[model samples]
Target chain A: MELTRRDALAALAAVGATVGGGVLAGRYDPPRADAASDAGSGSAAEPTLSTDLLDLLDAAAEVVYPSGVDGRRTFVETYVLGRTENQPAYREGLQEAAAQLDAVARDWRGQPYADLDADVRDKLLRDLGVETAEPVADGTITERIRFYVVNDLLFAFYSSPTGGRLVGIENPIGHPGGIESYQRASMSPSSAERSGGTNER
Target chain B: MSADGGSGGSDGGVGDGIDRTPSPSADVCVVGSGPAGALVAHRLADEGANVVVLEAGPRFEFSERTAQQEQHIRPGMEDPWEMGGPRDAYSTEGRHYPLNAARVKGVGGSTLHWQGMVMRLHERDFEMQTRYGVGTDWPIDYDDLRPYYADAERAFGVAGAMDNPYAPPREEPFPLPAFPPSYSDSLFAEACERLEIDMHSVPNARNSEPYDDRAPCLGYGTCKPVCPSGAKYTAESHVAKAEAAGARVIDRVPVQRLEHDDAGETIEAAVYATPDGTEHRQTAGQFVLACGGVENARLLLLSASEQHPDGLANSSGAVGRFFMDHLFAGAGGRLDEPTRQNHVGFNTSETHQFYDDTEPVEGLKLEFLNYAGPSPVIEALGADTWGDELAEQLNESYGTHVAVGGLVEQLPDAENRITLDPDRRDDHGNPVPHVEWSLGERTERAIRRANEIQHAILGELGASIEWTVGPESTGPAYHQMGTTRMGSDPGQSVVDADCRTHDLSNLWVVGSSVFPTGGAMNPTLTIAALSLRTAEALSASLSDP
Candidate 1:
């Protein structure tokens, strides 16, 4: 079965429940831009995800996300841009990670990562084994890719309403679901029969 | 000498050094625009008194509140209110207290971000020494403030039910029906029923319906730092009402000190500074210091004179002593099933069953936390795995957590007080308020008791406890109390039973600062009640003369 965005978001909600939600999100100052090619830029342009980096994220999302989700480009573009806006330190890290992914892609398939077929992109990521690698800013290429590209994209998707709906959370933490939504029992398919109103204090 | 600025005063006074806006004197001058000052100003203005409220912060536009809420939700966003800066600096001599985090310095004051929990203090809360043999008794008992408590409930449109059997006697029902328990509250209900612990609906100042012309709660779930929907009651509403009733609320004017006549029997004027660095003295027949516990003490001490060198109303030597605050304790854990936490920000149910007037432990009030678990986005990012494995991790972890938090009452200790830090001066070149606070053995004991109850509930659910906060990790709940405590004796306290200063006849102090003995319940409701009573006394005195 093709995993849906809802399934991915539900997983995100589960992770939030485990860790106790939003407590770890943005708790620290965004790590200083890694000492990669995107590290030093004296230009006056505002810090944000570049057009090229967005394209790379779009391609990365194809393999990183659950298969068969629609509007991958628009979702990744919108989410990554919003995440990196006014965040120079964070944007630089993304740029560095994008560069690393492209470097590996060109070496393996003789094309930019975005130009490769979906299966090829998946194989490239798998071959790199970035998923199993430790996420580190200044560590190995796989670690930087895991830290900057994969995790950033995952956080964006899971935190969104679409992502939260994949699982059971209609309105994730930090998002307001009208008071009536909270007053009702869990809308998750498995627990829909468990009435919440009956046990009033 | 008084600087009337043409508002109407017997004595004419001039601004110091810089050109100041000269205005007519007011009948009553209120040196804060928080809930305490706003309520009093509205009541006095409605009763045909000329009132002027001086607020230290700028008037935050109500329309911009949604954008401010966005800042609170968005990561790495600047605080739209910009509450703390050089002008609002303070330090701590003992335990670190985040004063800026606990307070806001604007026209609406800290109510802008407070969770809207309102509860009446029990009768035993007044006569602590007589019943418990530990804390001092309040000059006025629960009966004295009962009518005013009802008035406050009506004024704020409190949503509650007559369900708390342990609550003090009340002649009237709540102004609005209680908010229904959150889904998470039901999850705790099962364990509470098994333990024979009682839980009841929490009284909230937030509107249940369209009462007082404000909208009902839209369940934004961000009640603490921001409530985008105006459902949660803020002092800003009262300030607006006071303005409608012809009360002049001057924002961005921080009152430096109170100036008294040469004999020092009464306050002559409130010396204040505007944003433009111009000093202006507001003279009135009567003055009310309605700043919070810390600022109120700082202001009184700032007004040192030859007649009262210790402070303006410090003849009793209790101006900045007996500071108190409730300590927080909690327990959290994960269950096998999804608990659906973090869906709501405010707790809808709580228990006062453990509250005891006769027990050596000051007692505690427990709350079923609605927003306790980690946010999905942060949890996803922090996980070690990525892709399918990460998704599987989130699926396994979501909606399986529960948490319980409670407030433990603190006893008044002169040693844990708010004093002036002479070394650190603010933007206005005035000394900052320095707090010296340490937990007492009694407070720790109450916290341990609270922890035991919390742990039992979490344990009853067969959940693995993730963390527990006890005396070692406990912190203040930010309900600052005592300081300028009220009492009948002139030598032991700064204010009398009617919130009138012992040394200065026309000067009055209000708000949680005048709480004789701190109670475990949230203090804003009690503060509102006291402010209403003081307003009546102030207006009656003004009309009689």
Candidate 2:
């Protein structure tokens, strides 16, 4: 089905279970350039992502976190910029990531930045992530972006409507049970051992 | 020093009429503004008392400080301990059960970042000394505090299953119904029942539905930071309520030394410092020292005068003794089936069998904790030190596993104490409280047994045990308590059963500092109940006079 933004959000909310009956529909929208510009005023000019890179990031996010019934993607465009400037290490990491991608792309097609097909892009990205590229050094420019993207994707997904629902993020305030035996067990050694017999199921 | 015309001049005329002095004066002076202090001030002000709560730390607000949150979540700033601002946090003296908890100084106190788990202590907890013979009994039993617990529950708008057969009896139903369990909780519940371990949903103080004008929890997963939605109950909420009630809460003022008259044994005034370092005095008809456990005792120790050399109200020499904290440990294993519910919410379902279990420890209760899925940093820490095994485990368990942990009671030990540092002082030049703690053999035994129980429970549930140990890399459980205990005899305790200092009739101490023993469960609910009881007593005293 072709999902409208409303349908997408509803599906996402159903998936996340975060939007209860009280959620005001259409209240949230992607921030306008005015708001974004205001928030980023003091920082250097905002860096523009090449359409190819954006496509690559979206494709990667889909593979890592497949779209749920909500049909909405988990990659928030803001995350790319948010981490880049507010996070210095992330900026350097992104540049190094671009370099790695270049290396992978070269090995396959000998073409530079702008000319790559969807199939070539997917193969190059997947190979780099799997076994082709050498392991990135810890905290290096290349390593940081890879970590940041993965972490951001995971965080956004889990916290999002669909991800939240799939994982079961309940309303903490209305939760019905008293102190759980498991929680109590987790806190004590003797009880933990006694209760250890039950966790396997 | 004879004040109030009472006749008891023993101890070198310390209470002689010769030193009688009028009580300090203040429009509204609150002693300890933890949950109780905040509530009382709010209620009294709502009744129109000019309330001024005395806290030892600078006034703090979650939104006002961004440094800690910014640094912790920022890509490279991933240090676990580096989340909060320096002055905004407290550290334990060593790796012990009395682990130092992060308490906020500004408006809300520790509630600003609390998990908002508000469960009433079972009725048996009040009579532990009598029933279990392993600990001292409370001056007032659960029955006495039941009404107050209800009031606090109403005030905070707790959500939980009132019908839970295992729960304590309540005169009134919860202000709100229970919140739904997350997916993870349901899975755990199913797994637990299969193994015959009892598990239930967790009760929380966060709003299930809007109560008292507060919004419902937004589920931001950033509760450890300030709740932007203000759904979590903090002293700040009470501060606002108290202000509306006509109470005045002066922020950024830290109480230093409390002055008591040597002759009459009555508090004269409290000496304190403002954010700017200027010294000031607040006198009231009565004075309460609600400045948390460590700070409360420190104030008394700092207020030593010729009349009471050991420190004001320290005749029994037990002012800074009997420290206690819950001992924490856990055993968890990988389940054969993917518990795909791991990421549903923060903790939801938990085991409760250990709470009233007759086996093992006769007197202690055990509480289970379902900490949300492991953070990436924690996941990395657990990964194999040398191989891609760490990465593989991280991938497998990242969002598809569930683990249960434990919170065990650490019985109080007199030798475990909080005392003044010989050569250390805070930024205000005030002596800082130092804690000296060592677990008694009973606690060690409890840990050994609990670990075994956890292993068995998980194994029965068809899970492979991965890690089983006590607090990782952190010393002692951080729920610090038992510094200033209450008892009937002045020879053995600092405060009386009423939480009043035996030596100084008008000087009352509140907070967990007055707890003689630290139970295994979280102390916030009990502490709130006790604070309310004290406030009731104070209110009566004020009205009668």
Candidate 3:
């Protein structure tokens, strides 16, 4: 969790993304380092996420994929690290997002992203630089951040065999674990509430 | 000598030009290693005929394919394993169908990504013109293919009930028992029964009980993208048998064109190119094309020679004409409670009460889906606003996703055909197959009626309709067929009763390309049946001569 120039360069080397010539500067801005170090996945340590960026990403994951009863893991951290280091397009956009987040935090309320209140944080994102006057379903710079940052984490979660299990799909297609039968709730109203199941609408 | 050692004489184009050393290849040269090609090659090889299968793409091991599927199974990713290879640039202009499925050029062919729904083309499907006074009749009828269909069921280890009251009569019982329907399927079946519709369990290539060396379906619900348990039958299974039976398989070798003799009546050799640009000539007594619907037609078009300027086997100018595909249309809805269990089973239920095989509506087969729907819904919603509120909605909706859809039969029109793409070319500079997939009045009417029926059915069930539009309404099912249609008359079709091309004696076409009139059903089983029939005929002729 130490934000050293050596760590930055090493992390950059690992993912092999183009290190923008604008900065080689190491900035700490760390969030709860003890929690990150204790996280189970090993790939978390190899990526160089500055404490500020990590804090910003943690908040982003929470807002993007609100935790269910199982609660969210530090999944966005892994996803961010995976894309920024491995994929060039994502890394460039995320780096731009990080810079944009910093600019937004500086003007509105002079505080770091993690220090900002949840409502303020949501508002900042809701009012992030948008392109069209009308609402856009796709193809905007702000929309690109959601695609790069938020959607990647969702994919990283749901595509896995474990993700399918969290929602009663014993095995998704890629999972080697085979399902013998479908454990579906009954479609009839009499048995509809079998497992805390109510009407969908 | 090879397993199929024979003093195979070079038939043509020997001393003219295009100089290349003729490799003493198998007795039969099978282009494409998919289901049709592999079945023919396997049967021929087992019959002691030297068979060499030329695969346009590399052979995929199950383990490697599993890895590819694992990565692609994640949302928003398309498995590269399910993609076509370099020989297909000229075949990718799919305006009506899925562009990615132009043709899967690998060893398993397109079956690698198929749903394993092995159903027969209806008896009336072969007699389209005879019964409905529309389209062209197949040279052979269902009776001719009945035995071959049974044989194919054994070969693919198809599982289903033999005595279904709804389905067309079969000569023998199914090889394996049918898998039980999921709760969603059962509900759909119940609804169908109440409506007085003849809903039945669909025949499947995947095992319900382990029959072939392959394992049984373990209900992974990911049939099309990839079947992780190897339960679903893919072309690789047949290719393996063909190889074990002494048929040689050369993967990553694309057959550029067929060389004919000075007489232009027989195929002399198959010229192909390797990955590193090494060219080789394979001489054989006969050539069979199983390059799928679009590619098979394109290959013939690409093989234009000095003698046959209109392209080889185009004496009738019908090689790449009369392209046909089933138009799919329907709607989906959410049930009262969680119904995401639809994805739990295979394509378990099909409704055939709509099928009439007449002029107005011959191809109306309904499919009740059994899977969670919000995977697509959540994906479309994206990560924005998808976190908290929508996540809760998704949790509820994902489990309650329900849908019903069906395939509408489309008649063959000369205008709706596959021609060489004048603007685009493949990596080898060959023109891709340009699909003119404009639907006719019949198909348009069918779709409108299907939407109404589906809308009514969902309304009757008291469920909210969520998704709809397909085939004529939206996109084609990628079930491309009839690019090189078959018939008794040589003037109207590309191939004959045995799928042999009219202009060329030793040339044959297999797979859905030779389908004279595609029924409103999955064409894989019929393709298998026709291929097996052709293999028997080819074997008999070779033995007699």
Candidate 4:
């Protein structure tokens, strides 16, 4: 529904292709369970998250998802770099977006965004209306910068195949199916009142 | 030719035929490995008839790529992103559609992506001319095909709801009980009852339990485009059965034409082309065309010769005429609250209360869309929400989404036909099928009624309108039927009641192509039943004194 990592991974799969009796696709197959579990393991050769722009984005990610900051950063770097692998034009655009994000952070905190205190960082996001959920477009430069960080960067981490596991969807796109069966409580008022995931609306 | 050539232990073929010549002879040769072809082949081979099945596409050896299948063919996604195959290679010479016809080219055929909706056309659907005075009557009635339907259900391992007076009359119960419906199904049933409508479990050719050595549905919720689990029935299961029963199935060999006798009343051999530009002829006592509607008609049209200047089976000029597809339509809207419907075994229930209502030839089944969820909504609307707030919103609204719709029956018109493209060619250098079709006045009228009903049903479920889609964008090409229609008379039909072409005693047409009218039901089950019936007739004819 949210164009999750499954949808992106789906783009790489073709029916005719096979390798050693295994399908050529499955960026998240069961064999890759080890890779997903260790999403934080990065090497020096990975240049995607090396930019200062990514550093600031990673700081924001750290505040939002403090428990798995390294994993989130790794997942984001991998997804972004994977998407921009073929298009130099799009890659450059992302780099430019990072520079713009830095500019916005400088104006807001009187310093580079990543260097701001945690309180200042939180207040800056709240003040810029970055906490809003609906997609915003045709906006101010600051508004666009806020969107890039909160929506693009944060979403890429949580929406990745590993990120889906962080939530509750066990068989997100690219992953092997066969989760143990269990009934989920409905999002009705009675269930919502009894449990927590669903709201009373 | 004897099925075993009288040496019947296990190797069931003419042992020296392969060593002698390239032409292989069989008791029956079938074109198209879809439902009709696979079922007929399986049944005939089991009946001790040597059968050869020629499929025009690859067998899709990559079975484990569920995501690719999900993206390419799952029945109702927002214009499924295809994996690019010959299935989606045909051209439309006539109308505008938001999506191309969801055709699956392989041994399993379109069934590889079907939703497993196994429903029977009502009794009145077979006698539309006598009942509603709208469409041509089927050569045979429901009673004639009823036994075959039951047989097909058992053969296909269908899980169905039985003992309902509302369901089509049957002598026996379902092979397996119905798959449990989702939360939305219950809500929709309540709404339907409140609105004074009857809803029933959709009879589907899917396994609710493990049977036939195949695993039950794992509830992956991808029934269209592809069923990752074997829970849902694809024609490949029958193809495998046919092969196991000694039917020789050759993939990637597109049949070119039928070699007819000088009188043009008997098919002697079927010539086909392999992928490597090699041509071979299979001499058979009988030939069955189960290549779906368009391809069947297209093949017949391609077999034009001096004796039959128009086409091989075009004496009635009906080989490619009367092309029809179920006029598909639906409506979707948001509910007042989350319905807890999305993400459970999707496409679990349907209601046929209004089937055979306005037009005897037409019927409509209402489906409670389990595919409705936040992700589809976001993707459909291109809502680029990415932050934590959006994620929370998605989790909150995951299940509340709802929609309802169904197939509306279409009246057959000769103008809506499949003719060969004069210039365009496929892999074998044969003219590709060119279809000219659109929703007729009757079908559009039916859609309006269906659209209104959907609104009332959703309204009864406390739905508040949020971007509703109606039948305007509905693509009817998904259910290709009625191209090579069967009838009682030779002057007006391509095939007889037994599904044999009137012009050629040994030539037969099966599948939806033989339907005189499409009755707003998914036609795979009916196609299977008819093919089985035809296989029986062919076997009987072959063994005649």
Candidate 5:
């Protein structure tokens, strides 16, 4: 069966929802989450995104992931609501990103971010992603925020059971000869080109 | 004679008393429960000798470890990178100062996470010292050791032997047939054949079929962390067998030093610290220090008593010298045809065209082995290098590309040595091993020349280059060998022909530490064979007056 990138992404979204729910329901211990929390907690006070900024983040995440039954809810709940209270790095990056978005909105529409319309908000977000308004260095506030958002999405998805199964990542099991032939055949340029050789073999 | 003396029996000596006091002791004490220690203990116990095995690490069970659990054990758990320790040190000259040893402090030792490629050294490997003016000749020739190799193969339950003509002459076939080629192996095989490099099934200790109650290898893809299935042979298997044969294996006991009498001609007993930091002593009829190349020598050097000023067995001054590991480097490329298979066989095929006396330089050989399933990090590295071009290429050839690389031979030099770090200590407060080593000029030249040969073969096989490292260049190669080499002359080597220390008659050395040269093949099989030989000799010697 041929699977397209969109199909894979959709599958990933569905898996992510199932896994996120499973994680919340205590199907498996969130080891990485615990480790990340421990590493992040170390004496430093955590930052939280404001309610308005969080709502904007939810909207942005929803646009990027628009499929699956719980797709919008998962992205919004995890990054916008769930992470804001716990993850200091995520909160700091998100707040910084919100300010950048507000500035871009102010410059483009000549209006405050809260005064902007939905169409203007979406356009400003898209434009901010492509162009930097401030004479920024290599890693600007917008760039860091985008990187964190993408990483958080991938981490949440992959750590989820549904997402793991869809991507064929079996838990500590053994298969002696199954993947070897497929790997050898896949060495041709076609598979490389298709995957964009981005996913490590 | 001393305050700690027990009742005397045969010798009337202080520690030589047979008190029958139900004291804990074994006929043979094998230090380091790694592959060599496990095999020796198993063999000794099988021969009805009471063997006591000591391991510094905890027993590792794969089923108990989750993917996340493995990551928690140590950072870079999947990748074999040298984060500085006693084994990672090098002399200022950039010549490797015996720095390639990878020691694991657990029941199965490093084999708990090996790549599972098992190949025997070629015939010429035995006589390298004579053929090439480098390294020392093994006291036992390949012919003398062939039977032991066959025995080890059966014990480990290796897959693959029938198709590999380049493999050593076997008295009997492998216990299990060759594992079916992985997609990556087959693709690489075709490329190898096209280049006339002669690719064949690579022998591995990992089971292809169910043998000796162990399940066949399942496709978990977590070979680095641990094998969920018991298919991959680890020292724990031998330890279990040894225990079943009445051998005593004491886990979490790290040997601190070997005690000797005033004469220092014989070892008295080994003093060790328990897991809870309590010191204990164990007396044995004979001692075998199989604590790997780095630790074995380190312990001997650390055991500096009043009797022996240098160390327990350093009268000849050759306790920890001439360490070696195969130099590994290569490039991978996309083949014109989609040959990458997602076959589950981990190490199915290998090529040995570069091995043999065909080279003008007298002392080098190269064996090409296959590697696939680039981990997420490696894939990310590839993607980062190629940018947008990576995604499509990886998808198309996800399992189709061929990766052929060589395990080049490393000639040993006395300058490449392992020593104890005068300062550093591990968690147990014992001094950590210090290694100072670098490849000699001959090794460097051989690697550069071999890379050219490999590149030519790859190009001929219609594979485009992706990225190549080096045969000569310095990087962390996992295969560690030599250091406490075995030889006939006590003046030039640490152990005699039977791997016994020249100064300490009761002390023996096992593992690749006794290896004089690091051949292009994996050292585990040969090490297992040598341990079996040591066990047989020790058992026979114990039976004598």
Candidate 6:
């Protein structure tokens, strides 16, 4: 059977999630939550995201991901939930970026960001100039969206095996691949021509 | 002398004379289980001698490497090795030598994070004074180390080819065939051909085809900081073999000081600290100080006594003087097409063509770096756009960059040295090692010359130059050398030709600390060769009487 891009992405994502989750299972110690009231109380409650914020991020991942890739919602959900277990400052930034995204959608589209159409949400992000703005925490809405929203989703996707394979990187950095994959030059146009002509066969 | 004299520690036991200790005794006690100490301990144990190895840090488990590799790749993660704290504290004086960044303290030592590039020093490296009238000549020549170099290659399972025209002479071929030039190296090869520069296979300690019972390279591409596979050679491998051969290797025990006899003629016992802040002494017939270039000198100075007041083995007053380290120079930019960088981690090709050229102030070696570009994840995060625009940006930038780097040799300067810090004290209450380092004028010129050559090659490739490292911006290559230098004279150097301390009879210091002059080549191979020679000497001396 021919392998469609969607099938390949799902298979690669399954392998990636299993490998990443298994390797990081027992040893993955993110920083503890530093709630001021819970500091002396000795609480083990981890920071988490709200349902509405999760919905906004899931919708943002769909607009940010490549058009052909499948399962963006689940991938974004898993990644953003993982972010909640990170440092308190990082988790707060994620929540704040999602809130700002929803606020912008309410002001422009008269609805929440997750309820807008995919094309309208995409245009809304571009109109906010997130594509060209520099990412900065505590900066403008565009900068925050660029940093905590767009870049975070892109990092979640491209760092995974499926997203790497979509861009022709069979094994991204820090991912394991056999020596045979890199023993020869990639079959790019220039390298193919050079190997065919001058370099040792 | 008691263990708490100038040693600066109070909690101690078993510090009587050498004859009284009989319980935890060994034939030899090797400090610092890095390449030098582990090799010496392994060789002695393999030859049926009772040896004990003391390491300052914990043994890193191979099972945790995948997680460690993850920590290394992900941004904003702490150092996976957890190298620095108050225990590993130190200060730099002149040029900001990041000491802990260049070193690790564990079973394998710094080789746990090394790139595994091993090159033998050229003949002129040993005869620097005779050839150029600049630095002092080594007490021993390349011929003395030629056989040991071959032995070291076999011991580390070095994969190489006899292709480096400027490489030092060798009698036997490498143990394994060389890894082929990396795909990105092909791009540099074509440019180097046009510039009339000779590029050849770099000898590496990583396995090419599973030599010495370790797996071959699986291309995990994290060889510098962490190699998930056992392909890359770490001294921990030999440390394990030493254990199997009846050697006792103790980890997380940092040696505070070496206690000597009344005459200061020999090291009687090594006072090391445990986790509970208790100090214990390990006595042996012989002692080898192999705690790398910096710590070896610091330990010697920390062991100062009434007999040798400047320090143990300091009648010459040269224990921590004449410090040296190799610096780096480079130029890199984006190519017109995909160079496929970051696919493989360790470099497979280099050029030693300018190593012996005197016009550029002697030793200079160039490498075609394999992991120069940003990874897919890094590119995706650094992109300014979102959606398909970000996808297009990642495709264009991921593999379009290439770089050329070189190692420039630095001459030994007595002013650039390691001294004991008066203000800061470690967990054991000993003064931390203070490094006063400054790059010399000759080294700056050499770095400039290397950058010129690198620019020529990159220009030939039609690449746009993005960054260049000049003399002011260049940093240490982390190949520490020449702190406790070797010479025949008693008043000039710390160790003799046999790596034996001049002021002490049974105390020997090995590793790059004893080098009179360091060439631009990576120093681990030389450290291994010297360790093998020291091990043989120790074994023979133990056999006597």
Top-scoring candidate (lDDT) = 6
- CA shift of B50, model 4, Å: 1.9
DockQ of each model vs. true complex: 0.23, 0.05, 0.16, 0.08, 0.16, 0.31
lDDT of candidate model 3 versus the reference: 0.68
| lDDT for residue B71 in candidate 5, whole number 0-100 | 38
List the candidates' TM-scores in order.
0.81, 0.71, 0.78, 0.75, 0.73, 0.82
lDDT of 2 by residue, B1-545 (tens): 22322243211123223222222345447755667578767665565445567665445544433333332333444332222333322334544333234454556666766777777777776677777777787677778878888888877787777645566788877788776665445555655677676766667777767887887765534445445455667777777777677665655556778887759488877776544455566777667777666667777888888888878889998887877776666766665554443221245555556666545453333334344346433333222221233334455554444466666777777777777776766666766677777766667667766676677666666777777765342134455677778888888889887788999877878788888766666677777777777777777767665
- Tens-digit per-residue lDDT, B23-127, candidate 5: 266788888888899988888888898888877656665455333222322222332222344323333234443333345677877787676777778887888
Q: What is the two-chain DockQ of model 5? A: 0.16
In every candidate, what fraction of the native interface contacts is reproduced?
Answer: 0.43, 0.01, 0.28, 0.03, 0.28, 0.54
Estimate the Cα RMSD of every predicted model relative to the unseen true structure: 8.4, 11.5, 9.4, 9.6, 9.4, 7.2
Best by DockQ: 6
In candidate 4 the C-alpha lDDT for residue B190 amounts to: 81
lDDT of candidate 5 at residue B252, scale 0 to 100 = 59
- Per residue, candidate 4 scores C-alpha lDDT tens digits across A1-201 of 223334333222212111221222222221121342368553323222223545665667655542423345444444444544444554454554455555556655657667887667666666666554332333554445444455444434433333443333433322223322212334222222344544433
Better of 1 and 5 by DockQ: 1
B-chain TM-score for every candidate: 0.94, 0.85, 0.91, 0.90, 0.86, 0.95
Candidate 3 lDDT by residue in tens digits, B354-462: 7763436458888877653755323423423545664555455466667887888878877777778878766666677777777776788887777777777777677
* CA deviation > 4 Å runs, candidate 6: A1-64, A71-156, A160-162, A165-168, A187-201, B1-23, B381-389
State residue B530's C-alpha deviation in candidate 4, in Å.
Answer: 0.3
Off by over 4 Å in 3: A1-47, A51-65, A68-149, A159-183, A186-201, B1-23, B70-79, B82-87, B90-99, B357-361, B376-381, B470-472
Please give the lDDT score at residue B434 for candidate 4: 80
Instruction: Give the C-alpha miss distance for residue A146 in model 6, angstroms.
Output: 11
Q: Can you tell me which runs of candidate 5 are displaced by over 4 Å? A: A1-201, B1-23, B68-101, B189-191, B336-345, B358-373, B376-401, B426-431, B471-476
**Runs in model 2 with CA error above 4 Å?**
A1-201, B1-27, B56-100, B188-196, B262-264, B341-346, B357-359, B362-372, B375-395, B470-477
Rank by DockQ, highest first: 6, 1, 3, 5, 4, 2
| Model 2 chain B lowest lDDT segment of ten | B10-19
Better of 1 and 5 by lDDT: 1
lDDT of each: 0.78, 0.56, 0.68, 0.66, 0.60, 0.80
